[model samples]
Target chain A: MRPAGFLVALLLAAFAAAPASAAFQYYVFREFGVAKEFPLEPTRREAEYRTPLLGRAVPATIFETTEDNMVYRFTVADMRAVDLVARSAGLYAECIAMAEAEGKVLARMPQRVEDGTAFRVYGQLTSVDLAEAGGRKQTNCFLNKGWLYKVESIVLPARGEPNAAAALRFSTSLRFRIDQAPDSP
Target chain B: MRRIAFTAAAVFALFAPPLAAQEHEPLEWQEYAYPELGIAKEFPASPQRQTGKYQTEVVGENAVPSVVYFVDFGDLIFQMTVVDLRAPEHVLRAANILAECIFLAESAGLPLANLPLDVKDDTQFGVHGRVVSVDLNYNLGVRQTACLHKDGRLYKMEATMVHPEEEDGEAIARFVTSQRFELRKP
Candidate 1:
């Protein structure tokens, strides 16, 4: 087989059987309402929170994968239940109160993607909730057609493979399932 | 084939007078400002800052930390790299920065020509370099690279496009001429 095709096949296999080895793969997530792709199959969890604005139990599905010491996570918070209210600012500020963010956000810029504007923020991601070491996290959060989504990559140098390139690929590959027609996601 | 032409032109550029910018009307331009580097210049479009590492010398052994500002517009790939040349780990660094263009043009299969540059800043040195057309898998492209060095950092800006064929030389010339450098007060 051609080298490119062979590599793709190997990656897909690795992604399917992530527990067995350290190989990374392309994983498409359909568990959530929207489809997202992570580098590996990823462990999945769901959490429901009561919002102060509407007193509604909002649901957010979190998908995460650890490889080469890096952590990749995608959070899909369906705000349709709350009429797509912009409450992310409150959430971000509430978390900051726990521990002043290590430092200011290094950078945040609007990224033009297929659907619309996605804001990407990155810097030394530190939390007062946990003991600090060294590493960083980059997050891209955006609202598309009423749904709010966040794609995050945490660099863990102590873990093993601080594969930053792979971490970025995971975030950049995120889309609201292009197969669905535009404005429908 | 490309190597031979690049070597000869590099030798010729070492002694040649600085290339003069072609006369042309200004095109729409945008400012690319980097406060950290204390330098800013105009580009055809908003540029992206990319940080990476590269070989400090022609030997390709010792790696030098670098940040490259790059963009793609119309038919050209424009790039500017700022390299920290203070010290790598082992291999000796080249004192002259003009040689960087020759090495890069040869590896990319683009024929090169260059000459010493004269600019406003006394602490700065520059080169007016050009690359001829060559097939790059998908298309035939040529390149124009202008290099400058100041303090302990080397700055290089290059624009490459498919078969520029002398017609687009003015655009490349405009880019090289648009270069501006500032000296920070101690």
Candidate 2:
């Protein structure tokens, strides 16, 4: 079997046997200036993020993986523009609006992190699942220096508490470098 | 009683004489700096200070401490409010704080125009704020508000003119332009 497929199969087996302890691993991406926990190895790729207010797309890096009908996505976008303080405000509003678009926002909380601002938003997805309770999503977005960090989890309602815990672990694990130089490549 | 008081105040404001009718001299301006609050702004007169709390969506059930320094000149009023948001959830969220202030400022009157502002401060990361001009309800007057967040506090400066004349423009400009943030080093 292919290594990637083999890894997914292994994750599926482990998830079926023990859903709560599904081989989560701590990942530290120094280049991105963030750390988080992932249930499976995430595929990293380059993409462009749209900032509607800014009227343009910016270069971004995306890390994504899926397991047991749950999708996890983490994106780090470099806003290569002047006046990030203004841009960051617009970005925060944009992120919240995007999350609200998925469905009804159940809750939102502002958070202060080292050298930046973070927001946690919980919402129920509009799409319904026949086999599950419903669809849900939680997004944690952080704006530090000129970089925007986004962590998202989409899980079926049936996953319930385990997934909630997993989501919390994934988002809370996110940490940034305190003394790192700003806008370092 | 509250309604009666409000009605009396509204009646007084509605029938109040205009600045030209009163033939009042140009008001004196002075810079009021509160080192403890790390803010300084120009006021037409010595302002009376009041302490209060401001509620917002992100702050949850808890209310944040706020201080307001205001001078009511009958014809024109100048006020400044500083909201301390040093709570764990509100730290570094100056943008959010500014948004709330803007919302409140807009809610007070009908928005006529807005100008985006970049308020300079002592920190490398200054404040991104806005100046909103509004026409107050009940024909009260015109109000111009400038709001920003710096160093964990939201600063809002407002100037309300009962009937601003052409000459009153300079005083309004002076008050708004003279506002600055000089955060004291810890």
- Best candidate, DockQ: 2
- Taking all chains together, the TM-score of candidate 2 against the true structure is 0.48
How would you class the docking of model 1?
Answer: incorrect
Across B1-186, the per-residue lDDT of candidate 1 in tens digits comes to 899999999999898975443433334577766767746767776778789986633324656788988766656667888777644311122222323333344456533443334344423222222232233434456666665544446667677765454666676666655665543421
Clashing residue pairs found in predicted model 2? none
- Candidate 1, residue A98: Cα displacement in angstroms equals 65
| TM-score of the second chain, cand. 1 | 0.64
lDDT of 2 by residue, B1-186 (tens): 999999999999999975453355468788877888887788878889999987775444678899999988778778888888766456544445555565566777787755556555675545455677788888887888887665567777888878766677677656665676754532
Question: Per the 3 Å backbone cut-off, how many clashing residue pairs does candidate 1 have?
Answer: 1
lDDT (0-100) at residue A10 of candidate 2?
Answer: 96
Residue A108, candidate 2: how far off, in angstroms? Answer: 25
Tens-digit lDDT track of model 2 for A1-185 = 69999999999998887755657776777776676678888889999988655456888999988877677888888864664444455455456456655664555433444434333222112121223334777777666545677888777665664346666556545666424433312
